[model samples]
Structure formats: structure tokens, C-alpha cells
Target: MNISLKFKQVLNASLLKPLLASFFKPYCLLCVAYEGGELGLCKACLSDLPWHSAPQCPQCGLLSNGLICGSCLNLPPHFDATYSLFSYDFPLDSLMQHYKYRNMLPLASAFASLFHSYKLNGHAGIANIDLIIPMPMHRDRLKVRGFNQALELARLISKSTNINLDYSTCQRVKFTPPQASLPLKERIKNIRGAFSCQQNLHGKNIAIIDDVMTSGASLNELAKTLKEAGAAHVECWVIARTLAKSNY
Candidate 1:
């Protein structure tokens, strides 16, 4: 008997959801409301979250009304485009902090579902995408965190969108200081030589999945590594973006 992928996913979700709910009833983490929907957020709180509202530069993905940024014009990053789903602010930042630092692993599904909504609402550039690569956490960091949040997100996205994920073909070779902690001038240097790509992805367009895009230093470095490994196009699909020009 042959089973379809969608049917299997639905069956798995149907089976596991009840078992999960039996242990802990679903509730919104932000408001303690019993109104958590499919995305683990109530409609009110979900709408209130800082969604990215400004028009963005096609090349850099920064809010600039489609104008190319100077960085893209003068020294273009290896990535072809960046897609940030929400603005990094307020409760969103708090939620992200809790998810990454407080071990809120279940929130990955919420983030991925939110991205799917964005895609459905006419941001379906995902069709042009060929592969998904989550930003790698170095062995030391992975051991410390016990999980790579990006990879967790990539799994959900791959399942939802059916995009092929290549997690084993790249690695975080150098564990550098967190980009959020460094100044913009120092951020690039910190992430330099941090990633090593092993895949021979000639002519394929891939997106690196991450939770937040702050300075973009890490993503740019990873894109550089991927391009060197022969990926035709590299893009980013981040949950949030810090709109200001300063490093987060």
C-alpha cells in the first residue's frame, strides 16, 4: 500500500496532537488565554505582534521602498534576497528571547506557521526556492543549547512546504561571539570564516532559515560559504528583522 506525504503528515499530526494535549493543555504563552489556535497565538495577540509593514529593498530586504541599499550596490552580499517575516520589537522580541534562551522549543511551530501564513498572503516566492539550509550551531554551542533553534524551524518549514532540507552538508566551523552582542563594525569580522559548506549545489537556489535577522552578519557569512560551494542563489527566511541600521 502506498501512502502520500501529505496524508502521512496529517496522520502523524493527528496522532501526536492528542498525546501532546493530554500531557499539557494548549494555552497562549503571551496572555495565558485558552485561545491558542494553530499557530499557538490568539488572533488578537497574533495581529498585535509587530509584523513587517514597510516596503523593503528587493536586493537587501531592508525597509527602503524597493531602493537598493548602498551595501548591495557597493559590496553585495552573496545572497540574492532576504525575506524577514516580522519586525523585531516588543513582545515578539520577548517571545524570541524566551524561545531561544528559556528552552521554549514548542514555539518553533508557531513561527513556522506564521511564515506559512505570510506565504499564503501573496508572498509565495517560496516556489522559486529549491532548498532549505538552517544556520548551523557549532558543536560547542549545540552542546550548550542542546538544540539548534534554526534547525528545528527548518524541519517544520520543510514539512509544511515540501522543500528539500540539506542540514548535514554544512557546519559551523568557528564558534564566534554572538552577532547581537557585537557592534556592526565588529560583527562581520566575528562571523568571518565561521561557516564551511560541503554541498556542490550548482545552480540551485537555497534559503537559510533563522529565527531573527539583526545585523545579518551571520547570514551573509553563511551565504558566502554557500556561494563558494557553488550554490547559484542564497536567500534568508527569518522570523524577524531589526529595522534600525544598528546591530541588535
Candidate 2:
């Protein structure tokens, strides 16, 4: 064997194989240990996750079984309806953080599976969607992250649903600060006019896919933009939703 090829084989046996083996083994992200699946979360951790299965607002996807949550009923959101796979809490929140800020791409597939498992119930199926638009990230943020987590999730969803993915249709017009750092009121202002539909969406039932929904401000703003651009309906599909804080 050539010297270079022999050295390459040695490196793979001594370093690469062991490293990859450790990586593939299911180690829980919350608590370090073998989980059982590629999710890196054990069955117990998965079961303990705060899944949102309660009654939800038909419009904004808030957890209220009635026709709408108080916030949505009084002042309707721009999006016609919203749905999420899980609550933004506990281990799931941690998982999202890793995926978004930490650039953990593998976790995106796990999240997609959760979204797929969500019972549509009376909700519209992917067949009803004319286009799947992922919430866009500013150029600066996109450059730094290399990839948008929402887009990653959307790709997986499209593969499963066979819906048309339209990444270039909706574009981010401005670079804004992270929404989590801003106050609730500021979030709306920050994202206003931030997104614009580049392609005609007339009579199209669009579905906006996002990784998280905190105050629903960003989604509302994007939906409003699509509506003005001639979209017939705008629905939201998110991976998680931050629970509302109780008033004292």
C-alpha cells in the first residue's frame, strides 16, 4: 500500500471511527446519557417534554379551546390560523437553542418529526397549501448562521408533505435585532416592513413555516405582507410556542 493511503487508514481507525461512534450514540441533550434514538433525547425526556395538546385559538394558535384566545378575538392577528408541534419549554427549548444559535442541523429533523406527528384535527392539510414560505433571515444573520433553521425545518416538512417549497418568494428587507432580546411591543415594530413578498401570491393559500413563535408578532407581520401581496390565505406552522405568562 502507498504510504499516504496507509496513513489515512490509520487516522480513520484511531480517530474518525471512534469520534463518529460517540456522536451517533444517543446521548440525551438535557441529561448526558444514551437516549435510544438520533434525537439525543431519552424516552423519559421525550415524554417529559411540555407538548401542547390543549384547546388552541383557531387564529393565532394560542392554547385556548374556544373559537379564539382573548387576544386574538378582540384584535385579530394577520395570520388566518397557526399550528405548532410543541410548547417552547423545558428540554425542547434547550433543543431549539442548540438548533438555532448553536447550528445543530441534525436536531432539525427531530423537530420536523414532531411537527409531522401533530394531528391536523380539523385543520387544513399540506395539500391545501399552495406554497410553503419560511420566515426569512436578514442577510447579515444569514451570513453568520450559514443556514436558517426555519428553512431547514421547512425542507424536511416539504419532503414529507410534498408541498411546494418557495424560499425565494418572500424576502427579508431589513436586518433587525433578535426578537427574543426585545420587549413584546418592540418585537412588532422591529419586524414591521421587515418581510416582503417578491413573487405574486394571488389566490395562493400560503403556509409560513418557522422554528419558534413567541408573541406571534413576527408571523403576524409576515402574514400581513403576504395578504397585501394578494395571498388568499396565510397559515402558520411553527415548531414551538412560548406559553403566556399569567397576570398576577
Candidate 3:
């Protein structure tokens, strides 16, 4: 690239960016009400969010648990705790689908804002996070998706909380099928041995960040892997949690 072209690129980003953003109004992805700011949910929608701020059980965010879902009770997840901002449903699910599959990168900022609020409200087990780890995307999957949605959200959360993020320390070694597409029984097998965490996390509190939690097979596997690597505790912080077996 020519020096002049580089200069023009910088100039456009610095000057034209604000001008362009100002030209268009922001609106909620749900109601299309003008208020989402850089994110996609207006104030009304924001307040009305099915806030799953903290789960009674530090394990699964699934509602069937009714204070500590049966899954967690019967077979506790390796992760010590889990928390989410909203229950996965309607417009939120659609918005997340679009954000994840349809390449809506800007929506990450809105999701990150909710995580910031979670911290402010003092969600359980998030008290002292030694490290922030976004659920990793396999290298092949990364090329197809263009970016890791979890990592994008985690980047902002890491910035807000000033916690260290170690994406390189953990990796998705296998390109497993999407858990949502698989039967509940197959979900665990799909991701087994799929992650490799390089660091020795003994006594470290690791927050596994992700866009949503459905069956939680992925987070569970990640937590199990982290445990193998000596992580003292692994907690998951997700944008939404699916209550039903069906992908909401």
C-alpha cells in the first residue's frame, strides 16, 4: 500500500467514521426503538430482558434446575459456577443467531455491556477472576466464521474488568459439529477431547466466556480440560442460557 493510501485510510477511520455513525440513528434489534446506542437493544428492551443475572446453583443456567437443575444435581458440571444475563428466547435468540451466523460483529458491544452490568450487580463467583478465557474456535472454523464470537465479546469484557485474557492458553483442537445441531446424547461426544489448555491454572479462577449456553456440553468439556490443567475453578459467563432442549 502506498503511503498516501495509508494516510487516507487513517484519515477516513479517524474523521469519516464518526460522521458516518452520526448520520444513522441507532435502534433496538428487538423493537426497532431508537435507543440501543452502539449495541442493538433499546432501553425498554434492555430493562425487559429476562435477566438471569445469577443462577441459584453456581452450575447450570438451565431453568429445569429450579434452584439447581437436575443435570447439575445428578452430575455436577466441572465448572464451579455459571451465570448469564438473559434466558435465550425470541428476539434475543434471533439476534444472537444473526450475530453469530450472519456476521453481526457490532452486536458484541451490546452483549459486553450486559457482562459489565453483571459485574456491577455482583453476580456470584465472578468476584475475583484471575483470567478471562473465551471459548476457543478451531482454526478451520475461525476461517469460515471470520471471527470467534465468544472471543469478541470476551475482549470487551476483559477490557471492562481489566482481567487478563489468555486465548492462546486454551485451544479448540477439534472442529466439532455445532452442538445445537446434534442430539443431546451426541453433544458430549462431539466435543470430547476437543480442547487443549496449555497453561497450568492451579489455584486460578478462570471465567469461560461464550455467546450462549444450551446443553452446555462445550463449556463442560472446557471446564474439564481446565481442571486437567490444574485450574482451581472454572465459571462460565454467557450472554444467554437456553431453558429448553430445543435451540431457542
Candidate 4:
């Protein structure tokens, strides 16, 4: 099946499955209100969450009023573009914390559904995407965390988009400390040479899905590795983008 047709099927399924599930189990994740339609949030709560609608740089996802930000112009990232669904803020941050640290696994479905909805609205070059890759976690971190949140998300997204998902070709070789815990200035250095791609990806347009993008150091390094392995273009498809300048 083609990308467009697969997207339509996923869209239809996303809409219908949520409505049906809501009827059977109705409680919002945020307010405990009845009939939490999608993502387990009532319509009111969902609307109030910080959705990323503002204009931003296509490369790094930082605010730039819809144009390529000067940051990207000055120091271009390895990734060609970024498509983020939410601003990392307030309850959204709390939600991500719960999902990542507290093991709220069901939120993966919520996140993937939101991502699907965003893609359905249309992107100029999405159809050209040749593969989906969830950011890799080193074996040590995987043993500690018990799961790679990025992989959980990519699994659902790949199923919906019919895009080839490649999880094994790339591996995180360095077991560096979490980027979020490090100082911004040190993050890039800490993540450098952390990724290794075993397979050649010549001329492929690849998308990397992650739960959040803070300094983007990890993504940048991963993109660099992919480019070295001959990927033609790399796109970061993150669920949330930290809007704070400090995070960048």
C-alpha cells in the first residue's frame, strides 16, 4: 500500500477506535472527567495543553516566526527538518515525566495518535520519507529503563504510516548520562560519537522519532551518524519541543 492510503486508513482507525473506547472506559487523564475522547483527555483539557502552533524554524523547531531561524542559518543541524506536535511546558511536561519515568505506557498510543493527526494535515515532503527510526538507547540504559520510549512510539507510527521502520540498523554505542541532566554547554560534547549505524542508507529520507527534544544534541549526533552512513536527509519527528531558550 502507498503512503497516502496507509495514512488514510490510520486516520480513520484513530478517529473511530478512540470514540469507541471512550464509550466503554470514560475518564480523562487530566481532570477525571467523563468521556475523555482522545488521548484520554477531555476536549477542554486537550485544548488547553500547549500545542505547538507558532511559527518556528523548520530545522531545529525553535521559534522563528515560520522562517528558518538564524541559529540554523549560522550553525545548521544535521537533520533537514523537524516536526514537533507540542511545546514542552506545564502539564505536558508532567505528562511526559509520567510516561517516561513512571511507565505510563498507554500514553504511547496517545502520542502516536497526535503525531498521526499532525501528519494528516499534510507536510510538503513526508511522502518522500523512506524510513522511520526511533532514537536508540544504549543497552545499559535499556536495561535500566526497561524500555525505549522512542521505540514504543515509532512502532505505532510505523504501523500507521506504512513507512519502513528500522530499529536494529542503528545503535547507541556510548552510554552517556541523560542529556536532560547535563549542562547545555556540555551536552553536545557528551553525545558526540555516541551513535553507530551498521547499514548504509544512501539516498534515503529518514525520520527519527523521539519523545522530546531539548538541546537537540542527541538528535544532531544521531543525524550526523546517519549522514555518515549515507542517508540523504534526516528529519526529527518529536512529540514535544522545549521552547525555552535555555534548553537550546
In terms of lDDT, the best-performing candidate is 4
Model 2: lDDT of residue 47: 83
- Alpha carbon lDDT at 203, candidate 4: 98
lDDT of 3 at 9: 88
- The estimated TM-scores of all candidates read 0.86, 0.86, 0.83, 0.88
The residue pairs found clashing in candidate 3 are: 58-81, 65-69
* Local lDDT at 122 for model 3: 74
Best of the two (2, 4) by TM-score: 4
lDDT of 2 by residue, 109-140 (tens): 87787678664433556578888889988889
Cα lDDT tens digits, model 3, 21-40, are: 54586656677465655556
Candidate 3 — worst ten consecutive residues by lDDT sum? 57-66
The lDDT of each candidate is 0.83, 0.81, 0.81, 0.89
Candidate whose TM-score is highest: 4
Query: Clashes in each model (backbone N, CA, C under 3 Å)?
Result: 0, 1, 2, 0
State the weakest 10-residue window (summed lDDT) of model 4: 14-23
lDDT of 3 at 12: 84
Global local distance difference test of model 3 = 0.81
lDDT by residue for model 1 (1-248), tens? 35797767775796777656745776776786777777778888988998886788766677775777766777787778878888899999999999998789889999998887784346557787899999999999889899999999999998888889989999999978777787887998888899887868888889899999888888888998999888888888899888886331
